[model samples]
Target: MSGYRVGDIQLDEPVSVLPQAHIVGNIIAPRLRVAGMVYGSTAAHDTIILKDGQIWGDVHTGRLEVAAGGRVQGWVSSLDSADYQRIREEGVVPAIEPGAATAQDLPANGRSVTRSDAQNTLLRRLQDEAASALAARVELEQTFDKRLQEVAGETTARLA
Candidate 1:
């Protein structure tokens, strides 16, 4: 394929295949049907149909229809007006001044980290903590179930 970023690639076809096409940016096409692969985020204004295609990034569209063979591995966001506004507000990070007076401003704590770094760290910590908690909960439930089964077995033996 061509070095098409698909930043503004528009298609009016009922169905289209972007095989061997590597899109590095966003896609904004309505009523489009794809049967290839997209490595970037997709924003469909109306509807998007995916057939045996792979989406490795985020998808923000109005209506998405995935065929039985289609696959999306990343996040999916709604394109509703309200959702758009909320995303715009929440997704945007305010610029931070390096000289701003804050505990993080102290260079002793390692050079002030970038916003992206902070976000990534927070996300990673949350993921780890959540996984740990889930594992602990599962273990507790299993132990409780085992104890209950043992108690039930003892009672049955005594009754017999």
Candidate 2:
């Protein structure tokens, strides 16, 4: 009517226009049926039906359907970038997350057994190994020192 007509355009029988329909700009839709006049480009996704209208611009679409008394003058292009931005903006995907798992919750296999259980097991094993190694080193050092003292005492007795 007032603004640009889009979507499906249907016509019943033979209808003629006196003044004629003038499309100042582009017309983008899935289908277009023109029986009057179009001065601008006409683009349709499925089909573009030009009955007896006079198109001034180019007609570029997926399919072009022309009747007996259809006339085109200007260039017509397909609807590619017409609704691309709207679709991209509307079709936004949100990110998903599994449950919460921290470093302390990891087991020996890096799997989550239990948070405090895994941490306690790791800490207890480390402490036990460190204590055993320290005790062995201390015993070896004491044995070496005692042997050195005995050798010194034997040398002093021999000199006397």
Candidate 3:
């Protein structure tokens, strides 16, 4: 509540979300650093840091910092820092990993992939596929409901 901060910056009250914590609902607070699983959206007046966690819903905050290993399936929106007329905002900056870089950032000279790297690649692909399937299922359910309602409406009109 007190010592939780953003990099070298200090916040009045910043809540550090733990890895064991799984929130089924949204979180609206001054500052929040996510190291856990969040099933719902997260909105922070100051900042929201996604550090090695999964967020299934949108994230809205003044400042956002996503760690290299973090996963966010939803949109991330933020207001301009200059527009912050309230309390001074502090960012929960994630620690920089030594070799955290995208494929584009890597040198064109490709090195042979190691066994561990290949395993990790496969694991990430599996995780992504599962997430995609889950999202598709939700979409399919919504569409089915709408179609069912339309069919019911047409049948009622025909009977009437």
* Candidate 2 lDDT, 1-160, residue by residue in tens: 2222322222322222323443344444445666555444444544434555555544556566666777655333333544423323443211111123555555668764444645655554554454345445545666799999999999999999
Strongest candidate by lDDT:
3
Candidate 2 Cα outliers beyond 4 Å, as residue runs? 2-19, 76-160
lDDT of each residue in 54-74, candidate 3, tens digit only: 766556677777787887765
Error of 3 at 138 (Å): 18
What is the per-residue lDDT of model 1 for residues 1-160, given as tens digits with 9 covering 90 to 100? 2323434344433325465444443454444455665555555545444566665556676787887878765456657766544434454312222233445654876655544556655654554454345445545666799999999999999999
Clashing pairs in 3: none
Error of 2 at 52 (Å): 1.9
lDDT value, candidate 3, whole model:
0.56
lDDT of 2 at 145: 90
Of the candidates numbered 1 and 2, which has the greater TM-score value?
Answer: 1
What lDDT score is found at residue 23 in candidate 3? 50
- Candidate 1 wrong stretches, greater than 4 Å: 1-15, 81-160
**Given candidate 1, what's the lDDT at residue 108?**
77
Looking at model 1, which ten-residue stretch has the lowest summed lDDT?
91-100
